[model samples]
Target: MHVPEQIPDHLDFVGRGWHPLLTRLHEQLVAVSPSYSVQQVKEKYGTLRIHLYTGMLRHLNLGNTDWPDPDQAARYKDEDDAARALVHAAEQESARTCEACGNPGVPRDRAWIKTLCDDCAGHR
Candidate 1:
């Protein structure tokens, strides 16, 4: 499938319309933690799906037996929560945005599910 050049290679599977949203999400994620990296980005059931590489959580020994200080774990948990919230927000937005033209739209189901504005949907 066609992919946008502006987006990072990891997000090439996503549509151009979601590029801005994903970019903003990335910026917000980086602000949360430089260690965070995108694992995968794709469209699933007409909505955006973003998976992040949470190496920090592992490095911090979140769920391991060699758990470190409790305070450190708490801080990492907060950061992880914030990151998850951002991803959830972006996914919710993608549901209403036209995947083809970036216009406000609703999900349509035909051969496959996709979010498209009235104009784009009509053309389809």
Candidate 2:
């Protein structure tokens, strides 16, 4: 796998295609943790994840990306649950929100599964 040259604290590890959604997510995280880092980003079951899970994967939204605190999600413990919850919440938001226009969108399953706004849907 190719690694990124650097991982910015407040920026996303994904691409510009998801800027609208990611920017909003970044803003939300800044309100809580300014130093948060995004570990990954891609359309769920899209080109990114398809290299691993296919045939078995029928549905997907935005790609799965994790917030900071890697070990927090390993197992949701009493104390770690809160942290994991925050990360999960953000991820779900990305799945539901539009990656282009930052509007409410649903997962589109055409050739690839992607979360998009009505206007931006299939426009790519």
Candidate 3:
């Protein structure tokens, strides 16, 4: 594990084997690109939501449009709901099976906490 004293300005070890610095360089390149930062995205388009990015990429053919159409908005909402549901299901499943005690964990709050399943939650 050898870390360079200072990263070079334009270091290119293309043909050399695996380098950990490559990951950092890639991240820096993405950060500097117009397609990366939310601030840059907001400046170009008012909002910084993922759906907005999707709309910009998919619907308007990546044109210089800001607002999403009603159809796109609806689709985005549907996708959001589906994602939330998947997260909830995953959290609930995790709590339902306790690796430590093999007892069922209880859901703290139905609104916020994921509901545990019967086996691990201790409660029937």
TM-score top scorer: 1
Give the per-residue lDDT digits (tens) of candidate 3, residues 6-109: 21222232211112232343344333232321211110011111111222333344454677678877765554454334334433343443322334444445
TM-scores, all models, native as reference: 0.81, 0.48, 0.30
What lDDT would candidate 2 get against the real structure? 0.46
**Candidate achieving higher TM-score, 1 or 2:** 1
Ranking by lDDT: 1, 2, 3
Top candidate, metric lDDT: 1
Kindly list the per-residue Cα lDDT of model 2 for residues 52-84, writing each as its tens digit: 111111011124354425454342232234334
After superposing all C-alphas onto the true structure, candidate 1 shows an RMSD in angstroms of: 5.7
What shift in Å separates residue 124 of candidate 2 from its native position after superposition? 2.4
Alpha-carbon lDDT, every model: 0.76, 0.46, 0.32
Q: Candidate 2: where is the Cα deviation over 4 Å?
A: 1-12, 15-42, 46-79
How many clashing pairs per prediction, in order? 0, 1, 6
Clashes of 2: 1
Clashing pairs in 2: 42-63
TM-score of 3: 0.30
Candidate 1 least-lDDT 10 residues: 1-10
